[model samples]
Target: MQHDIAYDTAAGSQSITRAIGRVISPIAFLPADAAEFFTPVNTNKNWLSGEGKRLFDLAIALPLLIVLAPLLAAIALAVRLETKGPALFRQTRSGMCGRPFKIFKFRTMTVQEDGASVVQAREADPRVTRLGAFLRRYSLDELPQLLNVILGDMSLVGPRPHAMAHDDFYQSRISEYRHRFAAKPGMTGWAQVNGLRGPTPALEQMTSRVSHDVFYVRRASFSFDLKVLLSTPIEIIRPRNAV
Candidate 1:
């Protein structure tokens, strides 16, 4: 079964509707409290929601988007000149409560795969274009996700959204995996700041990332989100595990 729900965007004047498929029932494994967070009736009353996380997301994202407009345009032009596809890449990513949302990013690969058998990118994957390599290296490709942050499909600080394929694969491997979706996805997350960014080619690596994500869900707060935000620039400038 599938259902469509309207989520508020940063503007708050308009909303975008997304269809969430029932490929994976998050309620089956999510904690009762966590599961309730996604319910329509409980959506606007959660810890993060009630504590002004959405306001914070807009406060930061809106300005960043405006200030970075020129740079974003430059990058978009570069991507277009360097590649033959759209400047932005869109893929379905599992959001809070296992709902799927279309995530936007700067196209960084020759092939855009978003299916059950999507392939994870390796360090020197040939599918990554020359310019794409640089973009991925500095995490420039992820800048477009600020829109997702503004779109209410994500937050400024929360668990990172994995591809639907990765979500399906990992949920089966880790019993508590779905619990990470208790909070909305983020542009930069606890796992990313804690050196868990980039491709998780191994189950162990992914498990470690999931651990941090779940921890953030359990310990999410305004101050903690600020800490993650402050630490993010450092991580971006001096990327560790990022590919």
Candidate 2:
């Protein structure tokens, strides 16, 4: 099999094999001069690596899980009692380098309603249950994805993963869409914080969101991620464009 290497950094350039399997660090990519700016992380599957990312994800997610466990339980019970299906809904989402992983989220609709490219959820969609509507409004429905963050399928802050069907469409419509896979998908992302969540009927909306997603991929860092996470709760409380 052929592996694709997309390296962007001051380290000139070199190719490594999948079998070689070396872990590259942040210092290898960022130069001292541009460290203050949003230094693009090296994200080639080989040239840039996933070792640090996976470790960081686990470190953050485990503590969040332990802290949020009780709240998660209450939300799960609310979802179950308010809806007929399982409390958690799992779907195959595109992850780092386009790998697929089952993303977990609290069920927000009365029905499963997944298939080959379904419609994006809209405000007042009849599929949403009462509690589900509240959950969606406050972004409580997404709490279960902390599990995915812990499992390494996602990060606390990165490009937001789309439904596989949405991925197929956006990958074609937006050139930068595929570039989002350059990093691990996140539970929430740069786009979502800026009112990019909910139904996007226009291609330009997806285009804008994808552009931000790709931008985050090229400019992610520990402090940047922390800022995004810190703002998420406030954003959820007063979501500007939530469905």
Candidate 3:
């Protein structure tokens, strides 16, 4: 019962026609009211919406990718060498307007579980490789998402994306959860920079995280994004709840 994503070890995009017959079709489980959050509540003039945001994303993302190309390649090689699986991991995540897109990361686990019941990695999950732990801790595993940014599937700053399975499970329980989908998911976000990283198994933890996410959705602007970018390095240095 895999939901939106069906991993092809040999990756290729099937037509929208083929996808229906092959992978279990994508579905929209988000509440209709949640769509309202997609528009910022503030009346302030903001360039980080519409075409302006996309341009901003490309401006930052392209240069970062060029500078970090060698390191990204080294990570990919190391991931493949460490595990008997593909170097990259991709899973369908709910994007802006609740559209599903495959989010990419350097594979950090021995298992490639992208199905309905994909499990979150624990603090010392056995699935994580030795190198994988270091990458997750330092957030190196997320570098591939620079490509996501370049491709317009993500942003340089916004709410963090979650597995679609988790989104389906939590959307009903946590009212503010799907509000995070108001904007494109990001490599680093308001919640992540605020020390909300790692697994959120508890109801309270998830709720608190959603609060930050909802705040970002309402208050997003050029300055706010810069603040998240500046604060991210410190969180990387002294990560709270990092696994």
Candidate 4:
């Protein structure tokens, strides 16, 4: 049950033609919205569509590291002075093709801990510090992920990466959740910009996020990535339904 659809773009255009090849597993039999949409991918041996995305990610991320160096350094210093723990937080996150990679972020919490399971932080959570609150509010906490993008563990735009525990928890609850991994996880994404950011308290919220994630997969392109990037600042400035 695999198919590939390629959308033709203008000549010399740098748009991205998104595709997905479903890899069925016993775990993928969980329930999800019947209204979900998926654009199949051509699994033919001759296809070479992935190179465009990889090239684009590398090009964008390398320049961003240089461009944002000052801001990143300032944020790192701020987190260090405001917290007693390390400045950068690295944690394993599920990424493209269900592979694992360590994601980087500025530590916004007083204490950092890792376990078999992870929990979404809610508003007024005691673990969050005053500076952490500001960082989370404006997404300054995510600055370190620019390095993740540079490292090819993430992209400038796509679905936000989730904790391994959260991914496992939601896989049983939302069938389409795994589809998000069809592409690289992002620093910001359609879900975050369209009001899916922060703590997700219910299955519906997760469903909404997955919906946008899949949508971005189906309609992804360089221009679309730019659109998401442009919208992210607004999302942070006036965060709605965020934790």
Candidate 5:
């Protein structure tokens, strides 16, 4: 799945588009910073504009959002009744190229923690409200992220975005960790499909998840995305590693 491309660290003045094109070229030269972000090891041949996946995300997300409008309303109501805060939880997450974007989810915890001191959720964590727990277990809390897909901030299948604080910590600890950000974030991802969902309580768990993510980035294609999409429903129903 690997593509061979030349590397030149002196192309710092080129635009990101040019930089990406260079990476795909047989004789490529990229700036040092760009090289760090986009490498041949993680770049796929079918990774052009990704318009097909983007269109697919909108195609499914738009209708699903409309069809599930009522259900979403009900969930919001439940969250509101169960907690003193807003039903929707918005937190900053690192997007492609390490850009910051606010991610949306259903409010699952009693506290809205968006700071550097945010803690990972544990099984039967006291911070999780009863209704919130149900939402999280089924991953219904991620429904709101459909909006993010429509807005071009995410995709239906890719690597999931970590919280800003978590990203900062992991990028420093794992050299390949930040490589996952080359692709746009997703609601469900290769890691999730492979049972890497839920809290990464251990560093090894997070590292394993990153491995799957980098694999997706290298092998990403229209067909591969379809497989991930089709397999997702079965995973959801069976409820493997989800919290």
Candidate 6:
């Protein structure tokens, strides 16, 4: 974990399509300073964090669950038949204010490691099943987390949750890491949509992801959440760092 904490502020440049998307989207993808892009701007004490965010979550997740019921059932069945384990995978993850909650996913791995110490999935890992690989690639494994959103243990948009072990490991080394807990964890966030998804074996990489998460925490709003939701499908089709 001994590495420079600095993240490249140069988000460089973006295309015309992305430029237009930046205006409507809350997360930045423009040629502007990425230092500004990742930095948290609003630290005002008066800003209400949970205001309208829950209503937004229910508004979107409820309909999505209804629409994808058949697909969810089919995926569950497929996962069960693919391996001997349960179709759904559950693990303890850090929620708002660092509280612990069991997060759900469609089991895409042959092994369910949920102990105090859990390893992250690497590319071409042998533990992945043929069906599991497809599920992870398209992010179908995350469909079950909509239940978490409904259950109010999570949000439709916020910092992506991490295992307790990961929280323990990085919180000490990274100064601003715990700031992510200011809001509930998310199904997708500013990090994932910007290709910051998946493993962070490198310290600087984790630092960048935390920066993005903190950015969301300071700027969480209906419009920002809407933009993150809109960008999710695009990220799924061309997944960046998902293993």
State which candidate has the highest TM-score.
Answer: 5
In model 4, the Cα lDDT at residue 79 comes to 83
lDDT of 6 by residue, 102-200 (tens): 999999888888867988888898998999989988899999999999998898888899888788788777777866766778999999999998878
Q: Where does the lowest 10-residue lDDT sum fall in candidate 5?
A: 24-33
TM-scores of the models, in the given order? Answer: 0.83, 0.78, 0.83, 0.79, 0.84, 0.80
Q: Write the per-residue lDDT of candidate 2 for residues 1-243, one digit (tens) a residue.
A: 122323332223333322112222112232222222222344333212346656767787899889999999998888778757799988877776567778888888866645575677887899888888888888888888888887666788888888888877776666556566667778888998888888888899889988888677776776667778888888998977676
- Model 1 residue 84 CA deviation in Å: 0.7
| Candidate 1 RMSD computed on C-alpha atoms after optimal superposition onto the true structure | 9.5
Q: Give all candidates' CA lDDT scores.
A: 0.79, 0.71, 0.78, 0.72, 0.78, 0.78
Clashes found in each candidate (C-alpha, N, C closer than 3 A) = 0, 0, 0, 3, 0, 0
Per-residue CA lDDT of model 3 for 46-134, tens digit only, reads: 54446777788899989989999999999999888877999999998887657788999999988888769989988889999999999
For candidate 6, the TM-score is: 0.80
lDDT of 5 at 54: 72
Q: Candidate 5: which pairs clash?
A: none
Candidate 3: global Cα-lDDT? 0.78
Span of 10 residues, lowest total lDDT, candidate 6: 24-33
Worst lDDT run of 10 residues, candidate 4, spans: 40-49
Where model 3 places Cα greater than 4 Å from the true spot, the runs are: 1-48
Q: Which ten residues in a row have the lowest lDDT in candidate 1?
A: 14-23
Ranking by lDDT: 1, 3, 6, 5, 4, 2
TM-score (C-alpha, index-matched) for candidate 2: 0.78
Question: Where does model 5 exceed 4 Å of error?
Answer: 1-36, 41-49
Q: Candidate 6 regions off by >4 Å? A: 1-48
The C-alpha stretches of model 1 lying farther than 4 A from their native spots are 1-24, 27-34, 37-45
